[model samples]
Target: MSVTGTASDIASSESVPTSFGEFQPVGHVMVGLPTQGNVDALIDALHEAGWPPESLLRFTPGQSVEELQALVEGAGPLAGFGYEITLLRRYLELARNGYRWLLVKVDGTDEAAAAVQHARACHATLAVHYRRLVVEELL
Candidate 1:
């Protein structure tokens, strides 16, 4: 129920753990959206899907790294869904190149599913994979 892949060791000789269960952030989901145009509908859809206004983490191009980091950190870990920090950083890089991203964490299975469905209906992207927490145990 865990993966041993390091952020910098994607090709390293290590065991890649995998599992399915009530994983960490078990009921949360992240939504990606376009940064331009009218996003009010998408935001409204998210709220209608049970996501609180305070749970949204919206990032746009030209946003400073510190600002984005602060927003992500403020949303806390569970809201990160299954994306690793490295991957999140990569997302930021993409954003800098004109890709807008919306990151959110809904609080339950129904709500997460609703959000995902609504996102897809609205043409936004969704990520709902279960991520195992990587912990190092020395014996």
Candidate 2:
């Protein structure tokens, strides 16, 4: 899926998920960087590594904070029973601290692996792959 635009654009287009419930956002990886500069560098590195710009969506700290807060508040009661909720809370904390996020669409394991490599190289603070059945933390 070729989704090109700002975080708001992609989020509204439903190409990038605005929230995570149980087993949600399958086939994508969310990488969090400590700063906008780091996120930009990661995006550049990802492009150099063969990922198209269309496959990446960036979220500034303000956007992330808003989205994450809404996600937690709107989640179902059972959401508290899952690790997804915990991760959402953690993401909220990071967002509040000025961390930016990149949501990458990955078609398979190879793509996910490559994304993780680039994320680490760019000093990503967190990298989580949302698979069909599980959320795997890559860093």
Candidate 3:
């Protein structure tokens, strides 16, 4: 089951070809989050691209992804806030034109799809559907 689409095309068009099975450091897929802020819509995009719901589970090459996962899953107080702050900081950095997309990665073959899905699954629970967005994955 492979996802084939323009979002996928962006990744595919890369002079370097990658697969949806494993991910390397800085190896990520970027998706255009909906301007409307709809996670389901993003999921639909992932579905269209053929990426698995839990596709962000595979891995490869380095401690970065793991560290990120630890930071995201921090059991300490204000863990969620920590991530929000980081994301917001990144957002600001990007606004300031100091953004590095590769720092935050989506290791799925269908990067666009994965990114959309990941963005959508930002703040929910297992019952809600956005819980899996923070987990690190490889492709």
Candidate 4:
């Protein structure tokens, strides 16, 4: 399915991540889909499930690869001390393989669970919920 909405309606300002550190993307679920079609469907499903448009961010493979490259290049020594770096590498690999991404803002386990349901329905290849001190794989 093709994405149907204005940029503001379908994407958040944080489409490009600021960093790949341990604390980055806390309170969000990062979902990766194998195709643009899956990404578009997941966005629609999330909206129908009452997730606000501003809480969703979409990233193309190109954008994902570019941002990840910059983040990896600028990472500090401690970046390797956590699973964040490993996750970043995985995301980079997926992006290189043409997977798209959706970053959804979630308040807690309940919200993350809800998002994961839609992600699963839309065939998301990866879904990771970033909590305050833990990264939980939801799919």
TM-score of candidate 2 relative to the true fold: 0.85
Candidate ranking under TM-score, highest first, comes to 4, 2, 1, 3
**Model 4, C-alpha of 103: deviation from truth (Å):** 0.3
The list of candidate 4 runs beyond 4 A from truth reads: 1-23
Candidate with maximal TM-score: 4
Better of 1 and 4 by TM-score: 4
C-alpha lDDT of candidate 1 relative to the true structure: 0.45
Task: Kindly indicate the candidate among 1 and 2 with the higher lDDT.
Answer: 2
Which pairs clash in model 4? none
1-139: candidate 1 lDDT, tens digit per residue: 2111111211211211112211133234544455443245566666665556656545444453444454445444554564444455554565555655444555545555566667677666435433234311110
lDDT of each: 0.45, 0.77, 0.33, 0.77
Worst 10 residues of 2 by lDDT: 1-10
> Could you say which candidate leads in lDDT?
4
TM-score of 1: 0.51
**Ranking of models by lDDT:** 4, 2, 1, 3
lDDT of 3: 0.33
lDDT of 4 at 82: 66
Model 3, position 33: C-alpha lDDT score: 25
